[model samples]
Target chain A: MNRLLFALPVLVLLIIGGFFYRGLDLDPSAVPSAMIDRPVPDFALPALHPGKKGLSTADFGGQPKMLNVFASWCGPCRVEHPIIMRLAARADVEVLALSYKDDPQASRAWLAELGDPYRQIGVDRDGRVAIDWGVYGVPETYLVDAGGRIRYRHVGPLTAAVVAEEILPRWQALQQANQ
Target chain B: MPAAKLHAKLAVVVLIFVIGVSGGSPALAVRPDERLSDPALEARARNLSQELRCLVCQNQSIDDSDADLARDLRLVLRERLQAGDDDRAALAYIAARYGDYVLLSPPIKASTLILWTGPGVILLLGFGGIIWVRRRRPVTALPPLSAAEQARIKSLTAADQGPQ
Candidate 1:
């Protein structure tokens, strides 16, 4: 009993130390989405452009869609634009976008300057729709299946490697599952 | 020292104590435009916002964050309150979207079992170890108290009967 007491504190330290040590390597910025496998939240926002139809959840079905949460104000969004444009040109997926809490004119100008990649753009001017979609930051992307369920989510700028490694595999899975 | 000088020194100590106790308030970012017209509702809104995490600044609550998303969340929360949703309902509505990470106090659940019970478990282990050690100790380990020592200890512990 005396020997056990001597070792008890060390044991406790080891357990706590283990948790902290494991935590040290985890990406703190990545807050895993709770919306995985859940159906997309219902929302409809005004079009970013004059005549373009605004995006809605109803448009989520019939294709494996890539929903990119972008903003003109966000720097990383610009960094990922070329990659998103590449994804947009791909035949396998329909790329959609949400302009999160950005000025319509600025968003429009930014898209025009960069070359628009999204098939449909929704102007989430107040960001209320973004809250519904669980968007905490700009440049997040969600992959929605044909049945409109959110299959996977990637926070931060979608890199080419991320698209090729993480997204492509999931997109393929969704395609096989839907068919 | 002069009486006035002594009083001034005492005043400075008291001022420092007050400031120390206050601990500098949380930086409030709730704009004037976001405040509800109804004071009671506004108070509730303020209280509720403090419990919601600002995802941008994960450490700061939405009430204390200056982020644009935080401001938008505050507006949406107020809108929900105006629409007759209870505090829990309003919070749940947001949590449904953002998950439990947006909540300052994580909800007790299967996944968060360690988070909720770890401190209690540690405390219990500490207390249990103390009791176990106490029980395991033989009475011979402690020397028998002398009559004089026992009487002195008893008297010393008695509040009113203690030495004047």
Candidate 2:
């Protein structure tokens, strides 16, 4: 019993040390989104492009799609632009871009310069729509299955490795499940 | 006497310096336009902003953070207040959209039990350790010195006294 009592403190210390060691490997900035597996929030905002109808929650449930929150002012959005462009080129997936807290004119110019890859683009000028989506920062991407439920959320600038390793496999799984 | 008076003067100076620094006006991050005309509603909005975390900043309340998202959250809170939602309703609305992480003080729930109880448990363990140590049996007192040992000690003292 005495031996057990002495071992208890050591065991607790080891457990705490293990937890801290695990925490060291985690990215502190990456907050897990509460919206995963939940339906996208209701929103209808003005379109970024002229003469086109705006994007809405109604556009989401009918197919597997990607909702990318981005801004012209956000530097990481520029870094992830090529990966989004590549995703947009795929015939199977529909990429919807939400311009978050950016000027419409600047977003238009940015899209023109970067080569527009989005199927539909919405301008969230006041960032109200982003708040509804629980977006803390720009350059966040959400993968919405055919049922409009969010399957995955990627919180930072997407690199080629993240695209190939994390996103594509899950997207493929979502696609297969839909079919 | 002079040293004591100098110490008193130094203490007074330190106290004044501390009070001067602490009593200065706090820098508020709330923008002028976000303020409501109604003082009561504005007060409520400010209180709510203090309770909400600025998601962009590490350990900063929305009321104190200058981040754009913090400003947006403050505006949203004000809008909710203007719309006649009660304080709880406004907070719930924000919490629903932003998750429980947005609240500066998380609500007590099943998942948070560890966080709430960890310090108390550690404190109890500390008290338990002290009590156990205090209650432990001390080593038996050493047996009284034998007569031979006493005689050796007396002879050593006598020799030392003689040399002296």
Candidate 3:
């Protein structure tokens, strides 16, 4: 009984510590990027447009670019798809999309439903292309400058406010700086 | 009970108290440096923040993390809250921009039915295991000791009492 009394607290602590250790181990959160202002990674993926060639790193050069990562399974991708289409209509900037973790047919169907505004859509079915692009989730948009340097990144759905206040101004500035 | 026993109990209590206090307090110092003003907005932000996942940290809520991206997400959340977005709107806004991966607790959609119900299914299996084990383990009966066994037990007890 005396030994049990002395040992009870240690036993309780082991249980508590087990839980705390589990929580500590599960510290799921994004790592803040160390890659800002750095050159974007090279990528080559099959084009969504039939009979057309895929996208490459050279596409990012000579033009200010917006790379939107999205998938059919993502609901937010539907909401942001129209805004991306609007952004793509501008000749001043190139809009490229990386279709992540999705079937090519599904992506085509989604684009068909939402209307593809992407000048070039690259399929990254296994997400390796997204990893190389430093993508954490779908619907992330990164603005790369004319020199292929990443200018800005928005992690979540792009809306009018985010577009006007953040993406457009930064893109315009990068484009003007190049000229 | 007795004074020595009380003293012994007090010592054990202090030891356990010290250990418990030290264990849980380490995480409190890791607050993100971001400023969140507007008490009403902050309250709403806090409540809504936990619903959103930090993409880099897949399992953790933006509110619970000190990660830089988590801080940025918190700022985004606050921006939406201040701009008159309700909880669902704010979540949907972020989701629309970032994807469903940004939600800490995923929505009740067909794709997420298994994820939402898996825990209950696992619990039921655990309870079923307990019931099966109880049924499998028979009501154990102690064997009857023979006369020789009783005599040996008596002899052992007498030996413990020494020479008498």
Per-residue accuracy of model 2 over B26-65 as CA lDDT, tens digit each: 7879878889999999999999999998989948999999
Report the lDDT tens digits of candidate 2 across residue range A1-100.
Answer: 8899789879999999999999999988676777888898999989999998678999898678888999988899999998889988988767898999
- Across B1-164, the per-residue lDDT of candidate 3 in tens digits comes to 69999999999999899989888454631254444667777778888888887666666788777665566667777777788888899888677545677777778999899899989997998899678768978788999999999999999999899965
Of 1 and 2, which scores higher on lDDT? Answer: 1
CA lDDT of every candidate: 0.90, 0.89, 0.78
Query: How does model 3 fare in lDDT?
Result: 0.78
Chain B vs. true chain B: TM-score per candidate: 0.76, 0.73, 0.61
Indicate which candidate wins on lDDT: 1
> Model 2: how far is A107 from its true place, Å?
0.7
lDDT of 1 by residue, A12-122 (tens): 899989999999999986787889889999899989998988999898978788899999999999999999889888887788999998999999999999999888999
If chain B of candidate 1 is superposed on the true chain B, what is its TM-score? 0.76
Q: Model 3, stretches more than 4 Å misplaced? A: A1-31, B1-164
Arranged by TM-score, best first: 2, 1, 3
- The DockQ leader among the candidates is 1
User: Per-residue lDDT of B83-111 in model 1, one digit per residue for the tens?
Assistant: 99999999988888888999999999999
Docking band of candidate 2: medium
